[model samples]
Target: MPDHVLITGGGSGIGLAIARALAAQGHPVTITGRRAEVLEAAAAETPGLFPQVMDVTEPESVEAGVAAARAARGPILIHVANAGIAEGRSLRKTTPEFWRSIMATNLDGAYLSIRACLPDMQAEGRGRVIAVASIAGLRGLKGAPAYSASKHGMIGLIRSLSEDHLGSAITFNALCPGYVDTDIVTRNVESISARAGIDADAAMEIMVSANRHGRLIHADEVAAAALWLASDAASSVNGQAIEIAGGQV
Candidate 1:
């Protein structure tokens, strides 16, 4: 059997796009998310896509889910730590709960997911770990100190892991995208509109303008980069953050 690819948050958005891209290439894929129905529906729509309900924030849940995936589809050769939450709040208004929640999902979740998959990858002598970090990870955003910090921590984790595993068959990389046109962006627009007391269109424009191309990115664009990173061509591309924001940082 082909090596199985596991994608967290594969029920929707960029994760779903990556799942579809890899599945079409004949890779067995296990997609995990918190919502069973959404995952099931996505699996129904995409052949070779298997659904596993998992909460990445919980260590036990991650351990069990990884084991179940390995049992059902063999050892995972590609682990995409793509599950995360993005929200913009000024440091002054960012509560401990808010900061912790973002950190738990964006930082802790990736750590747990990657840790769970590393053993199998190590045994197999080859694997790919693609983390869905954000451009905010590379640089700070105006009103999202907590979100930015969490993403930075994720990149730090990926970089540190790559260093620790240097010369190993496994490769670790991060995709930093700016304002992708996903459900997350839609929700962020609504939130920004309410918070900034502006119309939705204006709020959306704020995000659109953040990208160097002056537009929201497509999910497939990021997926394409992920496909490349998973390919043999990217075996040496470790500890690097590829920017998909359509221009220089």
Candidate 2:
């Protein structure tokens, strides 16, 4: 087993929850994000959590950040590519810039993060790569074609990597969670309300209704799936996109 775990976009939401869960299990956790303040605050509150300011969209930033994290906590035995941006834009309104922005963060970010961590993992002959994808990856989301595409790309990357490393100690998988109760959902509520000219409560209901259980999934629920995937019992569970969307997808 590896001594250290690294999580991108770990300052808040699902990433933070996974970091905290691993830390509770005695892993030295390094959390990286673009915001120094948020990372610092999260680290301050968590005993085993360390913070690194990294923009996953930038290659140099990812390389340097991964080096710093490795130096701080030793080789990253587990990596979570969780940094992403979710937006709701109709296909007709989605601009080139908007599509690229979402792809850069959700797809390119995961690629960079995994690439930076793979060298050490391969050298050690064992590691875990868990991507925090979404239900959008599995099916079309009504107003988020770009976001859906990005997540689909993420799942594709994970699946391809898993095949490349087949029979090796390393494993790669993706967590596809449905509407989670997080700041992203909060922001989306406002966006949905404005876009549809509806009240915020009604906009929230639209999201809530997307889940088969008629409610938002919790961050910890996704975190638990991540922990399970990282365990030795899941060594054979490779190249899979595990859904946590209350049977939505």
Candidate 3:
């Protein structure tokens, strides 16, 4: 098990679950998010979680966040780039600003995070990077063109890093989950309802039905996969998109 892990967007949802999972294993976890209050609150709930407020989209903020993590808890052995936004807007309806903003937070944010953390990990000669992509990344989502693009780009970034760091102690991989039960899913449900004139529950059902298993995924399930990736058991796993989509190809 890693001694120190840095997780972005760890204030809530899958990231927070990952923080708890790693902390339970006795790994000192540093969780970064844009909201200080949420991060502090989550840290209060989860033992050994150090909170660092950072906007991942900003390179300066990411650099500072990583430095803070290193200062507080040695070199970060595991890095989870889990910060992202899921907005389902059609190509025709999505503006340039919206698309760029999504890419900035999802794709570019992961890149910046990895870039900021590499030097310290390289010095340590070992590192793990787990990017939280989505099943939409594997295939296009009907109404989420921009969101799909950003996730696809995240997978691409992870794959490239894996290739670049081959033979080194560093590994990069991605997790692609469909309809995980989180606040993001709840927000998406509201979006679906408002846009399609359906009830929120029906919108949720639509998402659940998209999964082959016809159910929502728990955040801890995704966190478990991340835990595996961070562990020695998955040393050989790199540059792969581990899917938790029930049955999406």
Candidate 4:
């Protein structure tokens, strides 16, 4: 049997989708989030999914949570550092607190997650590290400098980790997805609608247009990408940021 997989923020949206996909493939999947109720509900419905309440932004919480998961399942061979916040503000309005919050959740959380899971990966001599980054990691996203910088740091972390363990069986990659249809998008639409004084549909349309295909990418599409990266076929695909945005013609 394959070693267990651990995914952060796995109670909903992209992370949950990825966890479900992996579980469907017969891998024991531990889905983690700060919300105990949400994770418990998801675990109850999913056959192979095990819920672990974890706040990625807290280092001690991560270490303890990861140990609990390890005790329940086997060593975590695949670590998906997917927990993150997607808040944005203009540079002029971005406060130090706001910046730190973003970094703590997006970048530092990823680092902690990786550090916690990497030992098992190192012991096993085979592993996969997947970080769910955003298109903003590839290019500047207007009005979201903090979010973009955090994602960029995530990708950089993956790249550096891959190099640090070069010649090992473990592979690290980042998924840079375009705007996907998720709860985050829904929340953003609401915020944008308020900020721009536009209707919800128009605000959502602005995000849809941001994708090259002129439509929001489905959560499953990103999940499929994660599934592939976790598979043996992607063993050679390390130190790269795979883009899920529809390519230009």
Give stretches of model 3 more than 4 Å off.
none
Candidate 3, residues 72-109: lDDT per residue as tens digits? 78888789999999899989999999999999999999
For residue 153, model 2's alpha carbon misses the true position, in angstroms, by: 0.4
Clashes of 2: 0
For all candidates in order, the CA lDDT equals: 0.95, 0.95, 0.91, 0.93
- How does candidate 1 score on lDDT? 0.95
Q: Write the per-residue lDDT of candidate 4 for residues 66-156, one digit (tens) a residue.
A: 9999999889999999999987789988999999999999999999999999999999999999999989998969999999999999999
Q: Residue 27 of candidate 1: its Cα lDDT?
A: 97
**Model 2: lDDT of residue 104:** 97
Model 4, which residues run further than 4 Å from truth?
A: none
Residue 96's lDDT within candidate 2 is 96
What TM value does model 2 have?
Answer: 0.98
The residue pairs found clashing in candidate 1 are none
lDDT, ranked from best to worst: 1, 2, 4, 3
The alpha-carbon RMSD values of the candidates against the true structure, listed in the order shown, are 0.7, 0.9, 1.0, 1.1
Clashes by residue pair, model 2:
none
Indicate the worst ten consecutive residues by lDDT in candidate 1.
1-10
lDDT of 1 by residue, 124-187 (tens): 8999999999999998888999999988998999999999999999999999999999999999
Name the regions of candidate 1 deviating beyond 4 angstroms. none
For residue 100, give model 4's deviation from the true position in Å: 1.0
Candidate 4 backbone overlaps, count: 0
Assess candidate 2 and give its lDDT. 0.95
